[model samples]
Target: MSSSPAALSGGTVANPRSRVILASLIGTTIEFYDFYVYATAAVLVFPHLFFPPGNDATALLASFAVFGAAMVARPLGAIFFGHLGDKRGRKVTLVGALLTMGIATFLIGALPTYHQVGWLAPALLMLMRLAQGFALGGEWSGAALVATENAPAGKRAVYGTFPQLGAPLGFILANGLFLIIAAILPSDDPSRPSQAFLDWGWRIPFLFSIVMVAVGLWVRLNLVESTAFEKTVKAGKVHSLPLVSVFRTHTRQLVLGTFYMLATYVLFYLMTTFSLSYGRAAVNGALPGLGYDYTTFVLMMIIGVVFFGIFTMLSGPWADRWGRRGTLIGVTLAIIAFGLLWVPMLAGGTIGVMAWLILGFSLMGMTFGPMGALLPELFPANVRYTGSGISYNVSSILGAAVAPFIAIALWSWGGGSPFWVGLYLSAMAGLTLIALLMGTETRDVDIEA
Candidate 1:
């Protein structure tokens, strides 16, 4: 006699692998949106609202320092969450991280300004920002590993790119929201307008994430466990201590993977922070050069994000065909070459600004697109989450946390020559290139048990 339909369906559960990818993509996008919303606010609003003291330059620097503090906390988060994820399950760890980020972001939005609470306001903001950074440390690695591991044998790169796309996509929305808010306010009274922004306008973005978190939770709930991980567990190959396992067995992959991300990480900071500062400096000057205002500069970034998405979409198929190592190596060289154009175009003004943003973001997309697949693929299935998370986050210490400060110091100390900055970017790319060359290609690594 034929088995019942329910019995047959239960015999082989539907993959629901697509659900896993969708969940990772949506959840990551929301988490990053929350994190970067604060980043954009740190540059635009926090200096005046929270640190309204001393000279404008000093206040701005102080605000950036607080922003850097968040980055400093990220490695800690990586270690903490990385341990939890490796020991517990990926879903629960990610859920806790998301909740922390969402709540912190919401609290930031609702924070009392310095005017209302004296020193207490900024202190609270700093604390919340620290939480934000810590949460992000775990979020990226978990989502990337989930998406890639659930993907079909040959399509890991393509599936993995969806999670990476969240960064630029979130950036677009975060900055885009702020841009709209900034546009609506009347510019007739400059100080009053900015004061009004500090009081309430800046908080709107942070508050929006509360809604985002609810949505992310709903989507995440439906996700099934990763098939690769499931296989490892069933085979009794799951590591008791994933972090220790990675350090002991996959030391080379850990070191190389982190170093390999150096260029892209620094490039990410420059695109967001330094570029905004440069645009502001130009607009305040009385020159007919490419002195576009913040709105214009951000709009240019929006255009570039489109290309970022395209290049990311292209990476999946390209990596699957050319191999991940080749794609990563070629892109690193391209970034190095792009650095050569910095002095010429940045000195040229508006057109130059557009050129630089376009070129930099294009290279960013290519390199970042393949990394999600490449990094995890480097590790054996037993410790994939812990190995990839540690390498990815520890790399942040060298590559991202100090990149903007280093860039600014270079500009200040070089007597106005951005050549130092260009060299800095090039040096990072060169480091990553060496790491990639020395690493293994995991395109054909076994995924199924």
Candidate 2:
């Protein structure tokens, strides 16, 4: 772990390329898995078990409210963990964040239901959700920096995608397990959850996170500090407080980076969270829905996530070849266009719905992949952790934290049509497009410099 000014001047890495990929990818995979596990349960189980047994809409909104509360805590987390990351180092900060998330998620499984503890159930739920958000706030940027900083020349974006790949992989694993559990405790009706699942089956995913967290810790513990970080240390450039430095000096980049991710966040939450509600709603509502079963809809989303994985991998090369800004601009434009297809595609039946899922997930992959490189590349190594973590998590509040709530309100107002939701997506993408246009290409930038 010793780094001299001379060794770091030449940028000597303690970790090889393979180690870089594994460390970055494994940490994020476990982190995102912990996240998606809660996300799936929030929709499928929380409303029924944790909230007061009354209005379904009220309960669901309550669940989402707690869910979005985490977004508020994320920036705080970014400040705390980002400080540790920029000053102490990425490896230790990442390990700490992962452990925090794992512990919170595991404890969530054992919490008492509303029937058992009344308001305390939801209160405790929000507390744990906030912990998850805080941990995730620092996790993504640290993982991204680890990958990109350790990358070989011209391959930063390629390596960046390794960490971004965790989103889809985690989604698949989390939901795939839920699917298996649902099978084990089959509901009498496709439309409703089995009593067994509501009572106990839902806890398994949350409780299982500790095992994955252990493996992530092992991989990350073996990682040495990256060359870029070493160089920064050798140069004595680590800031006293990266959060203050980033805000004071990097305001423009911070604003641009935050908005740049808006469309991706909006599109993502809509596709997964809102779609689950829309897909499984009654066919005879005021505007009418597709009337899918819970399992059927989740399965559809999982199928589409496969495309998300494939395209996520593909976007790496595209970003490397064409450059991160230019590539994101192209995909952001496509997202704007994709927003218009929600109504028809969703209404067209299973095939059309599948088409919508595939297309949405594909655009999601393309846009999200480059962000791993693009955000950290927005700033120098000195404040990279704070700057990137803040911008990224701040976007979560603007886009993801509110997207589902807004979309649901819009859906009801539109009489169940997804048209307004599509417009909302397009508008967010429009802002992202403007942001991308202002951003410079970072593909050839020397991140360690």
Candidate 3:
């Protein structure tokens, strides 16, 4: 195992491994916290608060469209931040991304609703959402590089999963906060004139991002740069234009990585964002839904996310032993099978919903775990940030950015049936399976190469 420089220099920390993992994990947790909070609000609060209160379907679609605007901005964020991350150091670019995301999220919490500011409310929300996307574009790849580059040899997959843990942890924290807020300001009845949750409860989660950002910045600012990046700089191998070099030399990796991540991105949004909308919609209405009360569904999602976190950790060691490609292939097959069974699972009511979510999240963890290592390993040290960030964020556009919007459209087109959504997911998983088959096993590769 290679012994890289510890995250804390000068001082002798007994466990440098813990420091690096925690630094990466905490920063990603903050990023996902800001990102997922907006996702939750897009489904729960934005439709009602930002859009004109008429035509439930149209309003929800508009809210989701606004939600997707950030996704559209992610690649641009990737290009900008990726260039900076490759040119400067990973640690500095990460700090900048954190600050950008934090300020945007906090401002979102303070924005006026449609009732107070009319069309201006959504307009401002759109801008904040774009900022969030830009920041997040750089966050994941940088965090992954930090963890994988610092990992002891043969343990890169395990260490890389540390950043992946943030996804489920962030999901839990984001929804858990919303769950508490919903409980505190209990809605008497949805039919009632007063809706406490829509009025003020939703803002609490977005407002709380300021606290998370502060702590993340503290942890990240104290960390040293990755040893791999330091070596590249010392060797004078740093590319003057990483984006150009990445395209010129590693275009295939970029294309392969993007498609390789398609299923993971699709599954993530479908389980977290799309399901929230599906669970809370009116069952007997023109657009049939599961008829679950808002709080009940949120609690269910929190429970499911717990399983996602556990399996995410478990997938790390499994990938290490089984090989990254093998683990991904098995998990992708499971995802395809799960998609095929979506109709029956979702139709089974509360028990079905629980089963559906738990199974979906478990698969999400398995597939998502090794990605932190897998994506970064696809590129050499010099352009790792630019290549991986652009690939991952571009995949977000093709997958997550359009997932909820696509799922909702499919559902509406299918007259509320989940079959089309299932087929869509299956198709995505199929693409990932092909990519995995074509790609090499990156578990044993040297990230600094």
lDDT digits (tens) for residues 137-189 of candidate 2: 98999999999988878888889999999999999999999999999999987
All predictions: root-mean-square deviation over Cα?
3.6, 2.6, 2.6
**For model 3, how many clashes?**
0
Error of 3 at 44 (Å): 1.3
Write model 1 residue lDDT over 1-449, tens digit each, in one string: 21111221335332355566676788778877886787777667887788776566566667777777777777778777777776666778788888988999999988888878989988998899899889888888888877887776689899889898888888888988988888875345432235567668888999999998998887776555655666677778877777778788889888998998899888888777766655555433321124456677789988877788789889889999999999999999998888777889787766776788888888888999998898888887777777787778777778777876787677667655667888899989999999988987889987553
- Candidate of highest lDDT: 2
Quick one: RMSD of model 1? 3.6
Per-prediction backbone clash count: 1, 0, 0
lDDT of 3 by residue, 123-160 (tens): 99999999999888988998998899888888888998
Cα lDDT, all candidates: 0.78, 0.90, 0.88
Q: Give, for candidate 2, the lowest lDDT window spanning 10 residues.
A: 1-10
Off by over 4 Å in 1: 1-17, 188-193, 283-290, 415-417
Worst 10 residues of 3 by lDDT: 6-15
Ranked candidates, highest lDDT first = 2, 3, 1
